[model samples]
Target: MLVYSDDYLEVIHRPASSSCILVTFNEMEMQANGSRFWGQRFCEKADFAALGFISRRPNWFPAASIEKAAAATAAILRQASERILYGHSQGGYAALRYRLLLNADVAIAFCPQLSIDPAAVPFDGRFTRHFAPALHADMEIMPEHAAGRAYVFYDPFHAVDRMHAEWIAEKQRETRLLPVHMTGHGTVRAFAGTARGLALIESCRADDVPGLRALARSVRTGAAMRPYQVALTAIARHPAWADRLSARFGNGFSSVERVNFLYHRANRHIRDGELATARDLLVEAMALQPNNLGPARRLQELDARIVRTSRT
Candidate 1:
């Protein structure tokens, strides 16, 4: 399911997991203004049981309003056994607020707006507006139970994120801090390009668990200069992901170079017995360059092979 406001909260269920993983998402545009537009799009990311509150805060949700929303979310998430909170931009701000209020086992925040209290607010815990998440109290974050982990991802080139990064580093917890000096905040691909989250997710698997511990050690150092390439590589390496992405985005965002890269990757998946994934990439190629018949024909060939194999 997808929770939508200005951004989308999607729960991705991988076959490797017996349960679903909820993703609380906030759109950069929506969170920029802090409005929660309700719809089915605002539904659960994964199973409501496995994943709970995905607060999508607008850019202007003050600091405390975001906290209140998150407090409500915490009540929802506690019902679930395993849960995580993730957000981008202002949404990240909300996720952090929620973590401060209810506390999640894990939170992935990207370019989160760390709020500073106005000097005139009487200094007695009454914020000028909403409840501030990162107050002086945040200086010593009292973890609820598990002593949760936070991985704050940001871009170094984006001076705004950099400034906030500097501020947050002061109140250090078990932090997975990443600075993408190359890519700015806007273009940072949370879905496909985030290495820290991927490493964490990969570690969950029993087989990759061994090497992942080492990878997890260098989590902050994994930011890529070419995030597009990183995303494509991730999709290519994972079965059916490229196809799923192609189906959703078409070739609108992908370039000619990306098309070619996907084609090669798609073919690799075909050779590796991932026909479903290969067919999806072929479809993406065909969509990107309709006049080029090679991909279309290749798709047909693959379909025919699938049919023949099924019959045999």
Candidate 2:
């Protein structure tokens, strides 16, 4: 069963019978479709022999409505084999919450935020509207009960990316943190060329992210990876260079080019689920740049949250 809305909220059902279900929130933002849009899109694309042809939209409810969006997913998965969840932005946050609802096979979030509360450390306003309620700290931050495989990707420049990265860093799982230098929040595009990493993520198996390995090797040696600015510029002209550079500089602070770096570093720690390290990094960054109230306020809020959780 699938539901529809004027916005792009939709569900495409298939009898594939894979326990793993993919639920993307406000994926492309849908337009007003008075008729069967998917069928037409499928027909047109399939006619052209386009396997990549899928529906797209440009409108959705605010991010606050993310939790409610999962209702559609929960209903569809009432009968399934295994469940793997994937989403970005509010979709990502909602997937995390919904993962708690089932024995999730894998939960993949591109760049999910922490919360929507005013007191919370925000990613950015535009992102928030799209990801609404999922980012809220009051959100259900559940322990991994399903198969427990999760991948969270973040970009420092984007607010949602920063928040998501921080959350992962503090999550304290034996997670494989993949850091892309100067990569924005949309990683599917960034990692499109990553066959090995893509295969690992899709299959829930890791052999070699030729990307991660080279970075570790360079760190083992004494090589300075490329800078984010240079990498970003090169990516616009030649995406291949970006891919090569991203693999080399997972957590090199030497290229601390923006305010977002603090969050990225903290998030890298969180990816390994070392919340303490993340917290400390947030604090130090906030102290060093007191002019920016976001980090300072967020550090205090997170510390209080940790304390409260510890007491509980």
Candidate 3:
């Protein structure tokens, strides 16, 4: 049921008689299409009602500005017996922020932005599009003043996400930081693709921290997690590693993942000043995933550089 809808956000409630409720938030810069959104689909079969929040923008609710929507959401959550929150990226921030307000039991945030305010995260510019709104909003502190425990999932090697997680842990004593290395900022998708996402969610729902930790470690070591392997190759920037990973893993990556693999390998070649190799890799990337614009744009840039160098 659509509980509240406004220009800024939409809150939908899927009521079940179960004792638990899962409150979800949408990622930054993503359009939430009714119940078909990512978080909704992910927790669909769980034995809990779902309260999904679809943000039209990346303002992080701007609590002072959207009092009506916030109040409505609070009312809905306050009625629930046991509430657990789930989200990825910007939605992760919401899952943490409102956990205390709603008195939720647990929060599972994947690669969450603790704060986008320049004052809080002065070095992070990943969300420059929402800077003005974030500045005006209550982006002063990490949402650590909550009652229930929060589990934060992020890649330790990912600079921005690591920084956010570290800061959140530093500020919030009850937070458990899980490092899912090589998954980059898309840990949710990486785990989902591996079919262990539901199990992890269930662990969180049960408040089984040990089980969750074991599952997360399996995500790092599991050979069936093709996307994680592909991401590792991309981060490693080695063509041979990509080839070996592809050979061992077979064609397990999505179309976009394939493009990323090629593009990153191409980028490595470019850095090495192997223009022809980089161009060839980008061409293959475009051929494999023709609709992906990253390789196309990189290809154009490579061609322009080649032309300029030839003229000189």
Candidate 4:
């Protein structure tokens, strides 16, 4: 049911008889101005009250109406015996930001950024445009003040993400930094790719950190994780493993996986000065996922470069 809607936010609430509540935030989608209730389809089988917040823009937990919403969320959470906050990427940031405000018992954040302010994280340029208006916002305090536990999942090899995780760990003693190697910034994808995401979520709800760790390790070694590792290896400029992986597995990849593999290969070819090969791989990627603007934009750039080279 719709709980709140304004120019800045849209909230949806699904009530259940269970004593537990799962509060979630939505991730930013390409070209989309607003967000939706994330994880509804996945959590349909579970017996918990679900509350999701959707931002109307690519704004962080906007300070404008967060307090009002937090009060309402806290009121709901007070009725439940247990509460968990869950999100990934931009939403992950929100889960952490509001965890203490809602008095959530547990928070599971996948690749969350602690702060986008240049004063705090001047090195990260990935979200410079989004960070511009939020610079003056106070980021000194986080969910660290809460007595509840927080689990942060991120790829240690992802330099920027690693930096953010490390900073968060240093600031918050209640938070645990779990390193998911070679999973890239999309750590949640790594969990879902292997079908172990729900298991991890359940484990976190049970407050079983060891079980969560063991489950994560098992997923890392499973067949489903191979495609993700292969993509990461190729993106890191080592395509030999990607070739070996494809040869062994054959054409068993999903469309999204195929598109990512092709894009990575295109990047490798471009670095090797094989523009034609890069162009062909990118074309294949575009064919697999035509609506994806990332490859579409990159393909246009490649076309312009090829035309310039031909004229010369």
Q: Model 3, residue 57: displacement in angstroms? A: 4.6
Q: What does candidate 3 score on TM?
A: 0.81
Count: clashes, candidate 3: 0
Query: What residue runs in model 3 are displaced by over 4 Å at the alpha carbon?
Result: 28-30, 33-38, 41-44, 57-59, 64-67, 117-124, 134-136, 140-145, 190-202, 205-207, 220-239, 247-250, 286-293, 308-312
Model 1 lDDT-worst window of ten? 8-17
Q: For candidate 1, write residues 1-312 as lDDT tens digits.
A: 222222323222212232333436464454222223221132323212233233343332333443444444444445545556666665565555556454556666677655534442222222235444443334222233122566666766556666665555555465556654434564235234344445554443223434543553344244332444334544546635655654554444445645665677778878888899889989988887887777878899999989988999
What lDDT does the true structure give each of the candidates?
A: 0.50, 0.48, 0.74, 0.74
Over 4 Å off in model 2, which ranges?
A: 1-9, 17-19, 28-78, 122-137, 140-147, 156-160, 172-176, 193-200, 203-312
Residue 248, candidate 3: C-alpha displacement in angstroms: 5.0
lDDT of 1 at 188: 35
User: Mind sharing the TM-score for model 2?
Assistant: 0.48
Task: Give per-model TM-scores.
Answer: 0.43, 0.48, 0.81, 0.78
lDDT of 3: 0.74
Prediction 1 global C-alpha lDDT: 0.50
